[model samples]
Target chain A: MTDRDTTPAIEFRGVVKRFGDNTVLDGLDFTVAKGDRVTLIGPSGSGKTTILRLLMTLEESNGGLILIDGEPYTHEMRGGKRVAVPEKRRRQVRRRVGMVFQQFNLFPNMSVLENIIEAPVHVLGLSTAQAVVRAEELLEQVGLADKRDARCTQLSGGQQQRVAIARALAMDPEILLLDEVTSALDPEIVADVLGVLREVAETTDITMLIVTHEMQFARDVSNRVLMFDHGRIIEEAEPEVIFTAPREERTQQFLSAVLGEDTADRS
Target chain B: MSDNLQTLGDALPRLGDAVLVTLQLTLGGAALAFVLALLLGFGSRSHRGAVRVPSRVVVEFFRGTSLIVQMFWLFYVLPVFGFRLESLACGVLALGLNYGAYGAEVVRGSINSVPAGQWEASTALNLGHVHRLRRVIFPQAWALMIPMFTNLLIQLLKGSALATYILLHDLNYFTEQLRRSTQDTFFSFTFGLLVYFAIAYLLTLVMNALEVRAKNRLGAGPTLREVLRIAPVPATAKAGAA
Candidate 1:
């Protein structure tokens, strides 16, 4: 912990997100050091996915500021006041971040190779030939090289998700957000999908903010785990500390419910 | 006395001219309507109030008013402002504006029918607004809109009958003349009905073919070759493969 550099890779300051009358994230503040894999664990509507959505700019924050690499990402300063930044600013931040959704939202309009290369070719201004070569490499990395010409709809759930991962990786993003990437998979194929992600976590230096219910996968990949409840961080620590010696009563209950175990050894 | 006889020969040529006029109005109005529908449809979804509000107003105004009255206004009243258009032009304008308002709904709804997840995915990919619509969204939506657009095409074809009221000398006009010369109302109108139905049927086929092409692009439904029966049902496909 002492060796951790002072510069933060991602930071939030009193960020608030709301939907209609509900406050999903209320005055949330946190920081992630560079190259940390943090998994957010909680019950449904506990603002775990909301945190990822806010970073991806899929949902606009009602208040506060999010800084990426220690610079303004969501809200900008205008006249000494924090204001919701314009879409242009948010889009610039979004370029460096990639997300894989729970539902494998691959473009049914394109082949597997086309889906991977589309953003790179159109958004990043990469040459078609260059993007295709890189996309093939990513497909190989995700273990889907043979499904290159297959349409997204033709693939099984795990294959589609793997393609989605390949699609996100082709852009070469600095921050990769995984939102229940395997939550929609069948139990049999879930392992196959997670295996790819495990490899990604092991091989890549990309900063990750993952939200998943699979505690074991979280433990295997993440250095830190943040337990959330009702839009606030109830507790956060290394997986070993949180799993084996959860200090908070709420953390213990949640771990028991998700783990389906009675282990509260330090209760 | 011979005028009363009015051989089918003389009347057929005049009817040909009238059929051409009706087609001109139907196709011309259809072209204009499609353009206006696209404009108002995309504009109605604009984030700015100025564009959206006025687009709604235009859609409602054209949809609420009578097509005949709008044609009359363009042809009859515009002269008061010293801007008279040709009668055919007036008919086309009125038909386009009225039907385009309806088509705009088809466009908006079909675009929305594409799943929200697709939009979210495109956003995550950091696609620009136009590229998102062009490269991703509209291709899906275009397939959805074509079926509904087909319905509008038929309606516009029928609505072109209102053109006769503007003295456009269309099929409806010639049919009326046929009744007076032949002095038989039933035959004249029945003939007109059959021709319009034929044209409408042709338009439907054209639209259905377009829909098949679109669906084939998405790999959703049967191929155009299957639907059109051009490939003889792949019973031979196995032989060729072997």
Candidate 2:
């Protein structure tokens, strides 16, 4: 806490991600404060999910620097040039972050408890007993205490997502990335998972970067909502202000299409 | 009948020794093949051209050439270059290299078959490359590899017959002896076929046991106890309960 004083949780400067000749993130810049619940709303291929992926170190930025908790994360400036950090360094820093994928991505080979405890026992070097105790606590938090012994394949998508949330929380990450976490769930099942996310947002001070289509859940959970268009922030404001009184035409058009409302004037 | 009995009795000692040699060659070659398969399998997937290109080339070479020629090169041809190796050594080396090349493809396919999500989930858990592969990736991949490995093991057993051609006496050698002495070609060849089938059946049983165990761990198949029935517990009942 002392070391992190006054430092932003995440800062991106001129970050670029290109796929062949097409650039997805064109020199994007943004900042997220510690403990801020920020929601990214955009059309498809707006590079919203790419931001979360980059911060999790799953995707590399072809250009620019990323800072995590005020420290250089993806890259560092060496002689006025951005150089990617060594993987070991990236790994060490990423231990402070966790992500929940849209697919749940739970290991089918592992039981629910195994999925939660694997990293703690092996990567973090926690004793099996210690890891199990923590995992049980997380399972309790996610409201799946009895499903710990169940195989991931046997569980419902909603239940699996709850377990995935527990698995990510078991690491005790300072920042959490939810990549359309409820998009893959069934309509009714989405509420059950969103309930879990809501509880976590209310309870923990952890910073959250969410990419979601659930506008209601986004409005409910996020402090700030960022509307992206073509790899840049076109508008950003409080959830109420952004959702109700967006300034950008692209944001209004996207919100109208996603929200199915007659808010935007096409003429 | 008398002649058959006499031939069986006369060949028993030599046949017993030959069986031992066959087991040794089978086990040794399989052991070497397992290691090479793993090395080349991971190496072929390596990002560096230095490792991947060479690994691919080696797999192609061993797989492309004939096993008989490999044995000849290691045993007879090498001697001319002053690199003399024992016939038994040559046989093991050739068998291992050939089958290992085939097994390497199995290894690569098994590893690749693990979903990309699994790899990302592993990375998210902050697992290092070796740790991730060992604890997460390999276990699932290993389950997929067992059936293929079982196939290779049996194939290697049959392939061991070629090993005998390089001046190393094995099961085929002893089986041939019974043929010449008894002048009962039908009985001798049938005896050899039966022995080989018996060995293959035993190997399949072992592999089936492994498959059952692996699948059981994933909660996807019949249990090991159900397959092996080592003790007489009720099939559906949990142990120590009834």
Candidate 3:
């Protein structure tokens, strides 16, 4: 690798995350280049969502240095030892990232527009009018313009997820994390959420780290695909290459199992 | 019967004055308790021992002790320790501290009931702790707290009747006076019971309205106007009228 001034969008070096007795992520190392779209595919409890949560600063890794835009967000070396970053600095780093959850966790107390504009108006210090205009545009992009005034609980799962997408986008984040954004939707509405995401992937250069079960969406939206198993990345390749000709035995086995289930469901 | 009626009529003005004092204590105590409940509730959830321990101690102390004893202590014992309070003040303070402790649990439980995902979403937005609680968590929690708070409020109102023991001359005091003077214990107690019931019922209506409003904000319940709207007459009723 040549020395370059430009920073990778995200870098996790020897990241270790554990929950009680369960070790979720062990000695994980990876780099996502600026503007790259990466998809993580793995079985349940394989730590795919943990990666997104850590990036969003919703969960702190037990041991690791997570770098956002080449600046350490979680910990930094001081006096030859890793020291936790101050909360003030951690918050500043987190501002560059946003996440949409599987549950479509839009604020139920807020309307769709309020949910979208909340962070922008409050955290980003944008004027309400400015945030509202931006929110309306994002709502229109997500095909939810008419539902802007509706309270989030009044929306269907797909609509709520779309609003969540728009809410993340409203922050104008440099990196976006999607953790099974469509998994909660009914099958008929899954496509609608994915369609909005597809548009986002196509039109924007926002770096994306996604954990999704939608194989077709993964193939369409991600430039790179990572296959995880038991807290380790078993394989990494282009989406097409990974889908068509995975080299690792574990990756091939996992793909066949998942695809078999998909085919069985369809048939 | 006429003499009893005349005696009751004569006592009405004094009873009315006492009723006003009772209302003041109930409303004041509830307001103070609400503020204390929110403080202790949030404090109990604090990440630091300094805040959480004290809050726990206060909540347990009030909850474990009897409210009547607390009232007597505040009114009678405090004066011996160079701290004097008026009877009304003592009654309100005792009610506030005692019930506030119970209300704190309601606040804590309701706040915890807000889904974990909501907290994660707020954190993902990079909202600071205060903003997260004020904007995202508390509003949803408020809706959950109202039904429980309504229960606490009614309990607090009934508890205010204990004020009579402290010489506050609230509704119960006048009822006792009426009983002794008229020599009609049954009617005096019944009248006091009816007044308390009426106040509690009114409070229920007010709290129900508040609950409806809060749930309406969450898109869960019908608005008060929608609930109150008269249903259109059936075609059968129209035919019968014709």
Q: Best TM-score goes to which candidate?
A: 3
C-alpha root-mean-square deviation, candidate 3: 4.5
What is candidate 1's lDDT per residue for B25-94, written digit by digit as tens?
9899999999999989988899999999999999999999998899989989999999989999998899
Point out the higher-scoring one by TM-score: 2 or 3.
3
Off by over 4 Å in 1: A1-5, A261-267, B1-9, B230-242
- Per-residue CA lDDT of model 2 for B1-242, tens digit only, reads 69898879988998888888888888889999999999999999898999999999999999999988999999989999999998888888998999899889999999999988888888888889998898788888989999999999999999898877887779998888888898889899899999988888999999888987887776565579775766664543332111
User: Candidate 1: DockQ?
Assistant: 0.41
| Prediction-by-prediction clash tally | 0, 0, 0
Best by DockQ, which number? 3
Off by over 4 Å in 2: A1-4, A261-267, B79-84, B228-242
Cα lDDT tens digits, model 1, A1-267, are 544456687899999999999999999999998889999998899999999988988888998889988779888789998787777877888898999999979887788899999999998999999999999888898898998997776688889999999999888888999999888987678778888988999999989999987788898899999999999999999999999999999999998898885233210
Better of 1 and 3 by DockQ: 3
TM-score of 2: 0.91
Worst 10-residue lDDT window, candidate 1 chain B: B233-242
Per-candidate TM equals 0.93, 0.91, 0.95
In the range B1-242, model 3's lDDT, one tens digit per residue, is 67777998998899889989999999999998999999999999999999999999999999999999999999999999999999999999999999999999999999999999999999999999999999999999999999999999999999999999998889889889988988998888898899999999999999999998888787775666766674653343223111
| Clash count in backbone of candidate 3 | 0
Kindly report which residue pairs in candidate 1 clash with one another.
none
Best-to-worst TM-score order = 3, 1, 2
**iRMS, all models:** 5.7, 6.4, 9.9
